[model samples]
Target: MKKLMLAAAALALTAGMGLAQDTVRMGTEGAYPPYNFINDQTGEVDGFERELGDELCKRAELTCTWVKNDWDSIIPNLVSSNYDTIMAGMNINEERKKVIQFTQPYTPGLPSAYAALAADADIKGGVVAAQTSTIQASHVAESGATLMEFATPDETVAAVRNGEADAVFADKDYLKPLVEQSNGELVWVDGFDTVKLGEGIGMGLRQSDNELKEKFDAAITAMKEDGSLNEMLKKWFGEDSQLFE
Candidate 1:
């Protein structure tokens, strides 16, 4: 009886993993709102990535499903084949491409910004918070400021609220909404230059998955040719998000 039970459990686990690999498992943090977040009402992944990924999968004729992962482990899990692709608003930076390949960037140019509790604060030579393994963190580390890395975006923002850090650097589009909702608790500060990082945001895939990469890249291109991609961008990021074409 014990051997039968153990075999059943193992079989179930293997079946589930096989299903994940058969269908394209779209991995995301589902914590970054607007870009990606869990809709409390629906209890599902609902945001730009959710919608965009669904559309891309449809265009590419692939069966895709969402998989939520921690921000810190996002890339590592992708490499380990825990999920098929990463569409977590990940920028197509050279540093990241060394480990994984990326489809054409889906997002238009969006700059990183800083936010803090103070209306005016200097980030120069001061402590700044950023999510670990992000471009923002790398920039802060090289800058004159002391860099404080957090595993999550919320924690990075919390560092500023707790006075542990002077400010948190992140995508302006993501931070702007947070600042507005803070009710005077947080304010945007001029701490960094609006430098272009990478091509833009793209879907991450294992380096060896050239066919998968081609499929997504072609799907993105098709969306660009059609007006559907632009409509999606407007719906999620607002009209401020320009058409990729």
Candidate 2:
């Protein structure tokens, strides 16, 4: 009996140590602007997701580390345990939910807009160009436009500007800057549909990690109630932002 009690105590001690050493590793694309972009000079991660990660760590009482991963590889890396969570501005959709768990949405999913360069004199109305395999691509395909698919957002934008494609559909947030930069070259068509866009973005975790998901969900709720989440959004997206308002 004495030996058995000693063994149990030793096992408990080891379990506690293992729990204490656990660190939450978060992954992001580190390319999307105002969401999870990396600082060009410091190579340090910075953006809304970084700030949100810090807030999540404070709430969960866990040490947090950020890992940079390419957008295309993020889901695979998460499944492989290359990271524990994903904070990139990834939309939570039924398709994605089939593989991973997502916390409560932090931002409201807004519709993407279709824009075309004014220089494209041959193009008549709103047509379609999009990054391949993206939600926007599907939207374009459904609209009956010959889908001009590209590898990246930059390429899609260039396609429209260079008249290779009539228009490009992208998230309103990303499209805003491009339209502004076009200096009157690109214009948003007023009637582009947004019904197919998925739900808002959220943190992605392994499907089996319910404990971490609960903790993160609770933290997000607390932040929303206390105004910290709104403050963070304002800091990055500007005051009068509509995301959480």
Candidate 3:
């Protein structure tokens, strides 16, 4: 009877391993642009992260699919096995590292900036809008500013435009295009230094998936070495954006 029980456990383990390799579902928030977003024309996930994820999967020789998830529940869903990996523009920080393991950073450290209608808008101690559950939101919450958290990144900017918040704090890359398109209506808050919040953006995986993480890390390394990753960064972000050496 003990031998039979051992056999059953081994079978279950083998099956689980096979399932994991069959198809890797990459979870992402389809709201963050240049990182990840839904293409209105294609109605599909399309962005820098999406392109990077596809290449990573190809190099790893893993069958992969994309899954759209809300930002607030992304980590929880990953933990619950709703997806196998997270390719969202998640940063590698000690706080998040406690919950999930991260691959080598795919992108260099990115700065977060504050944007408002006026260049000198109050950002240090005024109401600041940020996407909920993001590092920018946490920064505002601890920086003595009243944080106005919204579910979507768009809504955070909307809050500032509508005068509900004094400024909106977010990734500089995400804000750059918006600021340009605003045509003087929106601008970076002058004198407010941009803050480098996290280590860098990386893929988030389950702690137990060490092998999977290694596969992706290797692929990312290859991309960096070939300079393809830098090119992608330039394509998504501007040429002035940071890049790996």
Candidate 4:
């Protein structure tokens, strides 16, 4: 009887290991700092999203691996099975929802808007740079600014600083660091609204991966309930940032 019981336990352990080994391949731009950018020196991805993705993987009992991809091709790569999920700081919006599934938002919606040199004259409707294929680009075009699209957030900021673009439209968090680093070359414009900015950031998944989506959604919900999510937001974005408010 003892031997039989031992054999049964071994089988169960093997089954559990098999389940745990079902790897989840997650993708990120790895260029959006404070969220999921690659470390300049170490060359490894690190940021709030990297940490949060680790926690979510733990909660879901799945092995997770991250891959870096260009922002413009992220969604298409997901659709083509280049990865099992996307944990980049992707905003949940209707247009994105139409193409792929998203986990419940981990970060709340904060307004994205134009920012320019603090001393520069007010924007008079010239070329503006935004991440290509993003909602910000759509809004910029709608506002009658000629679109100068870029592949990453840093590039957009560079465009503004180099005088190649008049302004940049991007998330407040991303813009904040640039404004500080630019030595007064960038300042947020007034009158941006969160509502028009769309929804908060969430994880992206293949539209057909309902089971994985459900797991991620539940994990995020638990984090929110237990205050873990708020703690993370505070650590990265400060207490007064809209993410906490």
Model number with the top TM-score: 3
lDDT of each: 0.87, 0.79, 0.92, 0.83
Global Cα lDDT for candidate 2: 0.79
Residue 213 local lDDT, model 3: 94
Per residue, candidate 2 scores C-alpha lDDT tens digits across 53-100 of: 988888988888889887667888999999999998788888789989
Candidate that would win on lDDT = 3
lDDT of 3 by residue, 1-245 (tens): 99999999999999989977868999999999989999999989999999999999999999899999999999999999999888888888899999999999999998989999998888878899999988999989999989999999999999999999999999988998999999899998986647798999999999999999999999999999999999999999989989997
What RMSD, rounded to one decimal, does every model reach? Answer: 5.6, 3.6, 3.4, 4.3
Worst 10 residues of 4 by lDDT: 187-196
Could you tell which candidate, 3 or 4, scores higher by TM-score? 3
Which ten contiguous residues of candidate 2 have the minimum total lDDT?
118-127
TM-score of each: 0.88, 0.83, 0.92, 0.87
Reference-based TM-score, model 4:
0.87
- Write candidate 1's Cα lDDT for 1-245 as tens digits: 99999999999999999765558999999988788999999999999989999989998888898899999999999999899999887888889989999898888766888888875776877899999988888988888999999988889998999999998988877887889899989997854535566578999999999988999999999998987888988887778765676
Whole-structure CA lDDT of model 4: 0.83
Backbone clashes in model 4: 1
